[model samples]
Target: MGVGVLDQTGATFAEYLPGMRAVIIADENTWAAAGAGVQESLRAAGIDSDEPVVFPGQPVLFADDAMVLRVRDILAATGAAAVSVGSGSINDVVKNASDMVGRPYLSVCTAASVDGYTAEGAAITVRGVKSTVTCRAPIAVVAPIDVMAAAPSRLTATGLGDLFEKIPAGADWLVSDALGIEAVDWDVWDLVQGPLQDAIADPDGLRRGDLEAVEALSEGLQMSGLAIQVHGTSRPASGAGHHFSHQWEMEGYGRDWAIPLSHGFKVGLGTLAMCALYEIVIGIDLSSIDVESRLVAWPTPAQDRARVEALQPAPIIRESAVRASAEKYLPPDAARERLERIRRVWPELRFRLAQQLMPASEVEDILRRVGAIHHPSQIGVSLEQLRTKYFQAQTIRARYTILDTLEEAGVLTDVVDRLFAPGGYWYGRSPEPRWTDAS
Candidate 1:
């Protein structure tokens, strides 16, 4: 029914075996990265070595439907209670596969890179469209601080970006509420938002591998999953930014020809853009607000065939987004008049955000920080190619995201170019490695 976190604990898998004979599912990379330690710990905890089953290849590369069926077959044949040995992609495969077969599983997180470790839904690319499949939340989230700290830096950065998304996503939820498109629960807002704010304020704690910070961020991720469970939809945790990521996943096209960013990273950029767009449309400053950036140096679309085949989004999606922007993100007319807010502040906010989230800049920084692919050239995408056909990326998802909103309002293309141009506004904030500045 919920999640349990085991910190500095070895052989945590031993606890799940009584429920069903455990089958530890891990991919090649994960097995190499953290499998031996987990195996040793499990053996020490009294679970037999024969219980673990390592899936072939990397989890991300195994998102194909055939792989899911293979995993399901393994589980059914072994009658093993599902347990995953990685984060994000691996967890998603096991979670979704287990749910499809009505089984419970536990996740031993090797990285703190995504909020999905405890989420009840799996983000899967099916038939080239990135969509969430109903799934079971991990019964336990087991990760030692040392193990998580040792994870790939970009993976940790991805987690930071995922946590940062709450600010804009929560705001969008409010916007949707105002437009009568969906109901917003203040309870859900307070539940996840509180921890998210704490994590952002003290991100340095994470940088130092502080147990409290790591635990808090992990909790926040689970809280987001719980929020979705409360709402019976992703509305409480995902919004326009997620839609943009889904669109890119489906279309496989990104401007500036950058490598495909993670879902969290893509949403992070979309959050900044959505926030800026909200200010532009609603006429507010919001400049005092500081949001962390999730840079994408070159984001070329990744799904070519799907992008060409999908239809443009429904018109109401855009209309609802605009109405939501005007009603929620922007102050109501009377409130704006009395509050003495400056509309001019919006342009400055837009430019600053655009600069900070520039694909090229993000690519360089991420590459330096995580040693991951950062350039469009590296990913085989070019600006000319994207500019000529990037519109296809906008059609992959049915969700009404910020891009869709901008397209509806007729400002998306211009804004995208202006934001990515040379000497364009780059508002990236300096990374502080300690919480001293936060307090």
Candidate 2:
């Protein structure tokens, strides 16, 4: 929580897990980053512990079912409280594992690479499907400003990318609220939005390892997790933006460990893509959306299920589509009312969304300032590839994102196609990754 807080890892443990035996779980690289210091400090403060478990980092660590089970096994054998000493993957591993054994765990962040530090769910790949699993979040997170500032720049970029996605995520909530699909919790919304701009305001400072900037970024990321914890659903923090990231990971963009994609890298592109999609959305003439025609052409639940089955996406993706489509499918009577609602709310809803969403160009500028991936090709995904994913992504999540709303109104495909066509907002923008950055 401050400079040199790594020296107080023991104090964090005492305050959060008093009188309990501690188990340190980290990957080898993270062990070197902060694990070793935490171990020494805990002992110096008189906390008993078992030998730390350091996972091999040869292939780059990822959060998956196997890693969770390994940590769970360690927890079961030791019967000790856990200390998760890493970012993203490592924290999720310990978080999910600790949940399995009904134990409390705290986080000792080595980098601000993600906001899952105090999140209620763990992003884990179970049986090849990368999805969030419901689990207990870390009890407390100890982020040392100096330690975070010393980590690699790309990891900081990842954290910014993760943090920035919230811009469009907020707009997506507006979409759901307008459609009556979901309601926004304003208190929880402010928890993240209140500090978002200031938290990520210093991309250049962050690049130069400014301690102030680092602390802001760290606190901002933690605030996001706190918001997630308060809401009890990722709906407030996730939307079409995350669906794009999940689509990439589930279909094997993440299967090749040699090149190794960071989650935030993909999410950065997803954020930009969603922003671009929002641009198209704001221009659509919703007044003439032809609601009656859409309802007439709407697929029956059985037919929609058949349509999803026929897309022939990856099995897991297809499975998610089927489940989501069935859950969201509405009979013509209800759907007629929904479409009418959209037409009625379009003007005010669009205005509200405009207030909420950042322009794609500005989002890209912020990402470039922080050295994050802001283009499709950075992770080997092309504009054409992205175009295809927009359609596939809508079906993968039952959650009501703007994509779902557009599909209900029958404009999702046409709008996305226009974005990639010549003269569209994203037609020739950042075709290759470019950054005017500080470091």
Candidate 3:
């Protein structure tokens, strides 16, 4: 995790796969960044290895099911333990392949660009739908802080954007806790949330590639993944923000017409949207809810299924949405009780939610300063498409969140519509591009 720690790669690799051969997986860019040192380290540790698999760098590699199978076949044929040497996409491809072959792999991070470096599952695009395929975390992670802090602007910005996502994730957990749908996991909560603010506090410093700020960003991102690894669910780090990201991933969100978007950029824009939404959510007085009316208008299970069908995405994503929607639907009686809970806890819950979330404007400023994607259009997500996710994203995950809370209160549509209406918050904000590369 420190500077010049590529020297320790051999020790780390040996600790996990002693006497086993190393299978290096990297893209051209990452291989250039750290490949030579990794190969040299493995040999120094007396570990034999297969020739590194350096994929083309022209079109940045994607972690799709086909690529996973390709890498899995490579590893399976040689019977070597894997060593993934790239950021999110490369790591996910190798992680999924290693899991499929019944082996744990070590990760060598080229940049502080993703949480999945230490997360338990891989976010693989399967049949055009993004899914988190169950897999174990890397047995060992070797991140060079010096290398990360000196990496390109967009990469560090992505790390910061990924970490900022924890803010809204915490707020959503509060919603579920208040409604008594899912109890908060205090251990995981503290681990991910405790240092988030300080870590994201220095966007200017990070923009300048300052060592301390980058280190904080790096450590904070890894902790979020560690939470996922320990708790066995993305609940510790995902919320409506991730739902929005997942929606785009399924649709194959792109930087240009053909190039797919990075996970961090998707999450960054999603985090920005959710932060703005939270600003509106915290302002609404939940006590003003007309519970009796909501109970009268509450959807029956059949009606709930109908709504999901109407808003559902295609095939695989549709299947998940249907199953999740069915699992979380509540009867009129249960809806009434939940509405009552909201009315009772509205004040305190709002306070907690407000405390937990950063303002949308503040988050946007940080994003801009750090050179991350600060607007939806940068990722080719139109305001209308962004608007649809507010509803579509809710159906795909049964996990209780503010989205579910707003629905139970019978105001989800109203609140969401209000966000895009003229003169409303998030109505007309267009951010300019900063100094960032296409990659």
The C-alpha TM-scores of every prediction are 0.66, 0.95, 0.95
Q: What is the C-alpha RMSD of each candidate to the true structure, in Å?
A: 10.4, 2.2, 2.0
**Candidates sorted by TM-score, descending order?**
2, 3, 1
Question: Per-residue alpha-carbon lDDT of model 3 for 306-385, expressed as tens digits?
Answer: 88888965776777888998899887777778888899999999999988888888888889888888877666567787
Query: Model 1: residues >4 Å from true position, as ranges?
Result: 1-17, 40-49, 56-61, 202-213, 253-260, 284-439
Q: Give the TM-score of candidate 2.
A: 0.95
Where does the lowest 10-residue lDDT sum fall in candidate 3? 430-439
Off by over 4 Å in 2: 433-439
Model 3 alpha-carbon drift over 4 Å, by segment: 255-259, 313-316, 431-439
> Taking the tens digit of each residue's C-alpha lDDT, what string does model 1 give over 276-326?
444444432333322222011111233322233333443433333333333
Task: Give the C-alpha miss distance for residue 9 in model 1, angstroms.
Answer: 6.9
TM-score comparison, 1 vs 2, better candidate: 2
